[model samples]
Structure formats: structure tokens, C-alpha cells
Target: MTQETEAVAEEAFPQPGPQARTGRPPRRGRALAVLGLLGELLITLGLVLGLFVTYSLWWTDVLADRSAAAASDQLRDSWAAGGPAALPSGSPSGPAAQGDPNAPNAPGAPVPGGGPTSGAGGTGTALAAGTGVGFLHVPAMGRNYQVLIRMGTDADTLAEGVAGVYEQPYRAAMPWDASGNFALAAHRDGHGAKFHDLDALHKGDPIVVETRDKWYVYRVDSTLPETTKFDTGIVAPVPKGSGYTEPGRYITLTTCTPVYTSRYRMAVWGSLVRVDDMDAKRTPPAELRRG
Candidate 1:
């Protein structure tokens, strides 16, 4: 009776397996396992993406701003350290050749042959490519917003905390130069993004180019809010569609548009309004004075 009863009970309820004894669920199917793994991977990837965005948007701005400030300080220190040597007689925008009243004059004044002269006096002419030429101050961007102006407008150059001049196809015209477009380019976002507010510039805003010897005052006249990156005419000598029929001293500013993307270009054009000698105290021109 006992053996028969035990056999019946065992048959009705089997012994527990290893997994059941350990209180663990049965192993999942390969498909379920893969899905679980994918879920974990996706979670990890989301965290990585969040970190990347922080680095790109916030951390990069901090680093780029610091780098730009350092570069600007270096340029100003160099200028304060006695600047470049004197220019030779008859050099463009240099002092008039001895006793020659027809000698090239400073910017804003037409030279003997007509048109403004390149005001790169002494050290100005020696500014090599990728070198900082001066400081660009746009009050419309910010009262304290000033970026260094380098000679070549290249990726590496612009990332160094200042704007670069277009050196290929057409070299940028300097502000002191006569009857040409003094063009400049900077990043609209990231890597200092000096011109991020390029769209804020309005007609009549002042763009002051500060050199070691003079301040070239330009008054904003036109702005191309959005244009294809391939539209290079924004930096042209005449800057087609800039409302300028006659060649005169001009300044062009270019930047990427749409913020955080380089798919388009934005431009602001200004004509030379006047020039002021840079005094020992570095007095800004009247054009820079805002009411």
C-alpha cells in the first residue's frame, strides 16, 4: 500500500529541476536573449549620445571661447610690443615719398591714381597668411565682442578663435586698401563661433577694423541673410547684388547660417564711412560710438 501510494504521488508531481530548485526562471530563447541584449545596448548608446551633445554644445563653447580670448590677447600684446617696422617710401598707404605730394595716402583718401590705397603701413604689409592682422569689433554683436582677423580663411585658422580672410579664388581686401572689398569669414557656430549673431547686424551698424595704426570705420549697408555655401559672390571685390555700382572701399563679412550647420552662408556688407588715426590710447572712431 505504501509503495503504491508513493509511486502515484511522484507521478502526479515530479521532482524540481536545477533552475526551479535555484528559484531562477528557465533560460530564454535565443531571440529573446538577443532582444534583451539589444535593449541594453540601446540604453548605453542613448547615454553616449547625451554626453556627446553636451560636449558639442556646451563644453566646446567653453573651450573655444577660452582659446579665442587667449589668441586675441596674444595679438594685442604683439601690437603693443612696437608693431611692424616702417614701410619703404611710396609703399602702399605708407608715408608720402619724400617731397612727393602725390604719394599714396591713408585709407578713405584716394591715391594719386584714384581709389583708396592699401593702408598696410610698415608691418601691415608683412602680415603673412594665417597671421592675425587686426581686431574686428561689431557692436551689434556685443559691446565686448571683438575677434582677431587672420589672413587666411581656413578651417584650422578660423578654429583658433578669430575670423580669417579668404585667400583663395580671391584674396580678401584689407580695409585700408582702396576701392575693393575687405572680406572676412568666421564660424557661425562652434569653434568660437565668432559671428553667430551675424544676422543681428542691421544697416547702419558699425564694423570697426582696428589696426596698429588706424581704425577703419565701415557702416553696414546690406545683408544677405541666407545664401548657398557655393555662393562666393558675397566676398567678391564688388560683392554682386550689394547695391554698389561704383567701386569703393567696402567690407564684407561671411559666416555659416542656420546655426550649428554649414549648409548655407550669411553675409553682411558695409562701405567705408571714414577712418581715424589710432592714437596712443587707441581712441575708437566716432562711427563706433553708439547713442
Candidate 2:
């Protein structure tokens, strides 16, 4: 009713004290600080997790592949100089050639004395295949998967789509460079990240493979979608029609289709365009051998 009374009322209601701001005691600043801290912690954790995954895959692949290649190279050299007997029988140089880090230990094939000569007409045919790098890279998908020159499930350890190189009927199959179907299989989703993008690949896309000796570039020619049970008999030793013939060094890339589902498979077929030898200075070192 009086000027003094009105002034007192205004002070009493003046922007509720920090204590009664929310109808509860103050702690607004404390609560805000806690929330901010939690958010920062979460962000830091995410970054660490992402780095761990990337580095783990990268380094493991680098070591496993390097070891396998070194061993294979030794075996090949021994065979070239003399024969399997010349290979190591006990130590690192010994029978170790047969075993794989990701595969069960087994006897490896004795080296072939007389191998395919360079340019043997077979896409991949080559005597004493130069063993340098063993991996494939798909730039489009940021993929880098190990390649198995040996046979069996060795390659499947990191990726199950394809068996070890040794497991494949190598001698029976034409040289990768030879004029015939040169098929490679990799997991749809697994380690090595092989053919994971097999289904997503479009016509004319590039498929690049690097062996210690050279880099093979292939261009996708077709994309075939078949049911999970659709025989896939084409991968058999004697491939049926499957739109491929026994000539011209065709590169067949196969992976489970539908991205993350095994209900079916997508086969992306390609033909070898050019084989570039890294050491020959035809292509840059980075492009030839992925880091």
C-alpha cells in the first residue's frame, strides 16, 4: 500500500534466488558441469574405440601377410634352386612353410621345379610366381584384404569367402594372367574385408590385387545376383556356362549379396585389363603395395 512496501515486494520476487530457481535448491551450475563432463567422456571413449578397431585390423593384417609371404617366398626359392628337399625341414625355413597363422598346421605343397614361364598366355600362369605382396585393395570401399597364395582355409581365417590359394587346384587352373577365368573369393563380412562390396560394385568398377611381384587390375564386367542356394556351381573346378569361357583371363569376384545378409550372393565379374609390375616403375609404389 505504501512506496516502501512495494519496494520490499519487488526484491522478494526478484528472479527467484539461485536456491529457489527451479523450485528446488540451487545446483544448476553443478548439474550443468556434470552433464558437460559426461558428454566429454563419451566423446573421448568413442574416439578411442574407433582407433583401436582400425589399428588392430591394419597391424594384424600387415604382420600376418608379411610372414606368410616371406615363408612362401623362401619355399619358392628353394624349389627353384633345387626342390622341396632344399626347403627348411625344421626351423623357420623348415616345414614351417606348410603351416599358416590362421590355419591348421599341415604339409605344404613341395615347390614345383619347372614353373609357368612369364607370359605363358595363362592369365595367372607364371613359373615361380613372383611372391612379393599378397593383398587386394578396393579404393571405392576403403577395403584392404589379405590375399592367400597358399591353399586351403588359410585365407579364410581373416575372410571365409575364399579358401587358401594352395587349396585351389592351382596347377589345374590357368595362370592368373592366362586367358581363362581367374576367380577369387572373400568374405561378405569378416576380417580382411575382402569382397564385402561385391554386391555394391557397379559395372566398370575397378578391382585391384597386389602380389609381391605385381599388381593386377580388373574391370567389373557384370553383376550376378543368385539365391543363397543357387548352386554357385560356377565356382567348381569345371565351371559351367556362367557367362564365362575358358579364355581371356577373366577375374570373378564373389561375395554374399544384400550387404550383411547371406540369403544370396552377388558375383561381380571382371576382366584383367593390365598387369603392372611395381618394381618395373610402371605404377607408383603406394598404388602397387598398399600401406
Candidate 3:
């Protein structure tokens, strides 16, 4: 070949160096894999910590004393306006809430499990049951939020900071007061929000539901993580001896678990253990005043 022709060929097709010819391919692939793994790990970490950061910003850190005081004041005012004057100077007995068990009955009562089932349909049963929710309070975890009581998965209560009460009118069946399961829903983020830390509850944790002049104490019996689509069977009245049941009025609490993900829900259940007439006595720890 002519010298000129040889030079032109060399320029057109440059040879690869030692590293590029053999070692570079595998090393490059490994570097890319490491980067991919790091990216995934970072994404997961952000998801978990993002909720924590949000809660830190939104939660009020005044300790349980402040919460207790606030709750006391709210109860006093509510009672005075509703009837029976104030909650005494000290503490009172019975349910901090009061209802005649037979006060002519409202349109719909709270449903077992959570959210408004399809049973209510377009009949406004959802809205009616939604009203029965009244107020929600968790003393141990220090949370109190005004419940909105909406229906179905369409509405995300966490975004709204509202609670939901499921009621009848759907094809599905639940019991009435002292009969079937009464279910309610809220959120959990370690914030001063509704239902946060619900899953962290152990057996014997305190949960209180209030009406006007009655206070019913419900101790935590069990907590279940939502793996399936919340079986209607699980929400059955009395929990059906499934290890989460007890006598008297029972309450089933439900919420989304693992923070920001709806992939699963966490449920904490309690049965009405003690009933008190708040118009009677005054004491701390709630149990001090009996019926």
C-alpha cells in the first residue's frame, strides 16, 4: 500500500487502548449499577423521612399537659351549652358524653370498620352517619381533631385533617349501639393530628369517645395492619370472637400506616370497658371516677 494510503487508513480507524478494549466495559457497567442502587436507596429514604419532617413542622410540642387542659376547657364549654352546666371544678364520672340510648334516634349511626360504604347509596345516609362522629381525642398520644366524617375512599381525610364515620344504608350490615361494631377512621403521622400513632398502641392503651354528657373508656385490645382491602368480615359487630372482641360498646379505629403510603392501613381496636356519667365526679387518669 502507498504511504499516503496507509496514513489515511490509520486516521480513519483508530485502535482501542488496553483498558478500553477489555476492562472498561465491565467496570462501566458496575459503576452504573452502583449509581442505580444509590438512587433507589435515596428515593426510599426520602419517602420515609419526608413524613417525619412534615410532622415535626406541623405538630405542636406543648406536652400532654397543654392538651389535657385544652380538652378540659372544650368539654366544659360543650357541656354548659348542651345542658348539665360545666364538668364540675375537678373531674366527673361516666362517659364525658351523654345520650339517652333512645333519644328518638338520629338518621344514621356510625358504621363498623371505616369510611362510608355503598349501602347508604344516594340516600344521604353517609352524611347522616358522618354527623354522629362528634369529636375524636387520643390522650395518650396527645391528639385532638375536629372530625369531618366523610364517606368513601374518594375523599382523603388526611389531606383535609378530618375523621370519618361509616354508617348504614349500604347492602353491608353492622349493628346498632350495644349491638354491632362501630368503626371510625383517622390519620397517623406523629403530628398533633387525628389518629396519629394508632398502630403504636399496645393492649391497654386508653381511647376515649365523648358525647355531650357521657365518657366511655375503651382500652386498646389489638392493632392489625391492613394487608387486604379491609374485609367487611373483620369489621363485623363485636369483632366476632376474632381475639379483638369484647362485651359492651366497642370501637374500631382505622388509619393509613407507614406514613404517606395508602398501600396499607393500620387498625387499633378497643371495647367499652368503663362507662361514666361526666356530671358526677372529678379526677385524673379518668378511671378514678366510677359510675
- Best candidate (score: lDDT): 1
TM-score of each: 0.80, 0.47, 0.51
Candidate 1 residue lDDT tens string, 232-284: 77777788778987767788898987998889988999988777777899877
- Residue 120: error of model 1 in Å? 15
In candidate 3, what residue range of length 10 has the lowest lDDT sum?
Answer: 87-96
Candidates' C-alpha lDDT: 0.73, 0.49, 0.49
Poorest lDDT segment (10 consecutive residues) of candidate 2: 86-95
Error of 2 at 125 (Å): 8.8
**Candidate 2 stretches greater than 4 Å from native:** 1-133, 143-150, 153-177, 236-242, 280-291
lDDT of 3 by residue, 41-74 (tens): 9999999898767655364322322453454466
